[model samples]
Target: MADYTIRVYKNRDYNAVRMLFAEGMLEHIPATCAHVLKLPRAQFVLFISFITLLLISRSYLLSLVSLAIVFTLGRRLLTSEFHQYVESCQRDDLLDIEESYMASNNSCFWVAESNGRVVGMVGVVPRSSEVMLLRRLSVAKDKRHQGIANALCHKVIDFARQRSFKALTLETSMVQVASHKLYEKLGFQKTDVRVFPSLFGRFANFSVLTYEYKLRH
Candidate 1:
């Protein structure tokens, strides 16, 4: 078994983390669709049917059906729009780090590594003197369920407490029930809904639920 470790991200780890993010997102697709389709096999069949129809039929009806299936699958597949959003989040995180560095305030990125390979990451930013924002929490599928996210959250909370921050906050989609439950178990409370402006202009109606956790020092 490979030994897993969690550490602060270094500049050299950037490429590895980006690769891991792509892999993690792809791994999450099936589970994301399963929540809607309620059956993995059925979803697979529908996906195949959509592709077949797209290749064979020029009928407006078939194209419409294909479009619907694509919409359904794309939501779960982490398509270009989703990837762009995640990239935007990463850029924001880096910007936060740069700003904090300039101001001489502490900010850091953390990653989970197994056998010297990056597998997961979490970005933490101080929102105010008393609050921290937790964003971009992700783990490779194979490394999940081993308490990687739990450990990462705990570490960030500890870091916040050490810095005397009063609370931590995060936003996640309502469709991500497993993540919602995880945050709840970690003592986070849902506080509001957050509207994420779409970069692709396609998923403009989507919103994410926000949660907060108070850290008692």
Candidate 2:
């Protein structure tokens, strides 16, 4: 088991939280790309592209090369999509954690520290008067599956219940298989599923899942 303590976010933990979130999100690119490739639409597009190249160049070698290029472009598109999310996060809530999460009773952010180093973090923000959105849940790659994520989740759950919130909601990418399990294990129900609105998302048929955990009063 990893030795760590969970507490409210502090100013000193800013850089660590930002780094962890970015790394965590970017780490999913490969998995996401793989998921994309498995989609029938994606496969059909690749097939069409390969066939077009084969006819145009009349060379199997050139067609194979073109197929490889298509794969590379798809991966790059997903990479750009993830990067854009990270940048938007940094520009918004993450830009000033204190202001975004610490200024009000309805919102809060917390981090898990092991030996004074931030190893995990999670935050909750007001979605409405009775609901809170759980955001920024991330654990260091090396420190994952040691109960760090579970602990962070419980921290948010406890906070929400104490605040009289009716429910806690969160969203995760379809490629995050482990996250889907974690949320399910914690009693969150799949409330909705929607395709991500982006060039890569549309092309790959990528989607995001929304989960909600209702607090029992």
Most accurate candidate by TM-score? 2
Model 1 clash count equals 0
TM-score, candidate number 2: 0.95
**Which regions of candidate 2 fall more than 4 Å away from where they truly are?**
none
Q: Give me the overall lDDT of model 1.
A: 0.72
Q: lDDT by residue for model 1 over 1-217, one digit each (tens)?
A: 4367888877677777767766655554555444545545546766777667867895768867776866665574546555765576557644344343224344567889898888888877778877898876888877878888898888888888888888999888746677899999999999998655654232333457999999996
Worst 10 residues of 1 by lDDT: 95-104
1-217: candidate 2 lDDT, tens digit per residue: 5599999888999999999999999999888877877888889999999999999999999999989988898778778889999999999999999999999988999999999889999999989999999999999998887999998999999999999999999999898889899999999999999988977777777889999999987
Query: Which pairs of residues clash in candidate 1, taking residues 3 or more apart in a chain or in different chains?
Result: none
